[model samples]
Target: MERLQKVIAKAGIASRRKAEELILQGKVKVNGKVCTTLGTQVSSKDIISVDDKIIEKEELVYYLLNKPRKYVCTVKDEHKRNKVVDLIECKERIFPVGRLDYDSTGMLILTNDGDFAQMLSHPKFQIPKSYRVTVKGILDKNDLIKLQNGLVLDDGYKTMPAKVSMTSYDNTSNRCVLEMTINEGRNRQVRRMIEAVGKIVSKLHRMQYGCVKDDNLAIGSYRRLRPHEIKTLKKMANEGISE
Candidate 1:
């Protein structure tokens, strides 16, 4: 006994969100009766139709992308901006696991597997992300120590201690590249961490996310996750998914 929207999505009529819209508009019918409720449940044996058209189930797909800057992580943007799914263009209805801000670029995982997505995105599963960031000013020894030792933010929340190290620096540009690893994914956490030390982020890129890599995957390009990769992600999800 699941919501009708889930059945419509599994039957390939569109995404669950789209299915809900159809139901609200009185376009969905179950056994020749119009159904408009959001929580209407239908079993496998029930006859469901969308605008009098029959639907068939679609196979789930999982994919990963080396997302570039200026792209939203949603399925479709309300403002008609570019999205991650437009690059992959799969038939299955897939969505991003978490989110990367408009200026942030990194490895993003997309899938139609609801259970796996829910588990991985849940706060209980501490997923580590390694970011390669280029900042406007050079970081001194004290700055590094402060970052490692942890500092209080202006918003009155003390961030957890993080692993921060210098990768390289260009004296000409006066820009320094640093690698910061964190387990929790908070809103604009990396940029905020850099700002805490009076440094400005010039460029931000995620080098690695959990087990996913940006190796050989160019900006804005995506590829289907290999079988083993999917299996490993599932195992990680299972570790945190509550019964």
Candidate 2:
């Protein structure tokens, strides 16, 4: 037996939290009876429905997508913009684990496992994400030190210390390339950090997420994650939960 929300989430209907909301709103039914309680439990034999439509648990699927710019990382966009899910042709309903900014290109994971998504997205995990950035101005040694030390953002929250390294600089273009690894997943964080140091970000690309890397995956393309990779991620997620 499992909690109603957990069952709904495992069925690829919604995240656990969203599942609870659906229950609260009296949208969920168990064995033909509406269930609004948060702790309602049911076994596999029990009938489950949301909005009167019966739902069945789906086999979980995972994919690594090298997201391209101009694609939103969401299941649906209010503006009718193309979403990352739309890019992948899959029969099972899957969603991006987390978001990459609309304009930033990089590696993204899409999955139907809500528990896996929750484990990775939680800030407590401190999963490291690496990015390569191009900025309009060259950064000196002192500037690099400041970035490594951390900075106070416009929102008054001080960023966590990040690993920043200079990759290259063009004297003629006054542009600099930097690689940064950060554990925090703040919105526009890398760009904000560069802007705080008086530099304008021209381009940004994610190189890696936790143990997953862009590798040879082409932009706007995707592939299934190998067994070993999935095993490693599940291990990481379990370890994070235990801690």
- Model 2, 1-243: lDDT tens digits are 889999888878887888899999999999999999998979999999999999977999999999999999889889999899998898888998888999999989998887778778877777778999999999999889989999988888798888999999999999999999987888889999998999999999999888888579999999998888888877876676321
Which 10 consecutive positions of candidate 1 have the poorest summed lDDT? Answer: 234-243
Global lDDT for candidate 1?
Answer: 0.80
* Separate clash counts for every candidate: 0, 0
* Residue 28 of model 1, lDDT score: 94
Q: Give the C-alpha lDDT of model 2.
A: 0.88
Candidate 2, number of clashes: 0
Candidate that would win on TM-score: 2
lDDT for each residue of candidate 1 in 88-202, tens digit (9 for 90 to 100)? 8877767887888888898898887655565567666766678899999999999888877777777877776778999999889899999988766777888888898999998
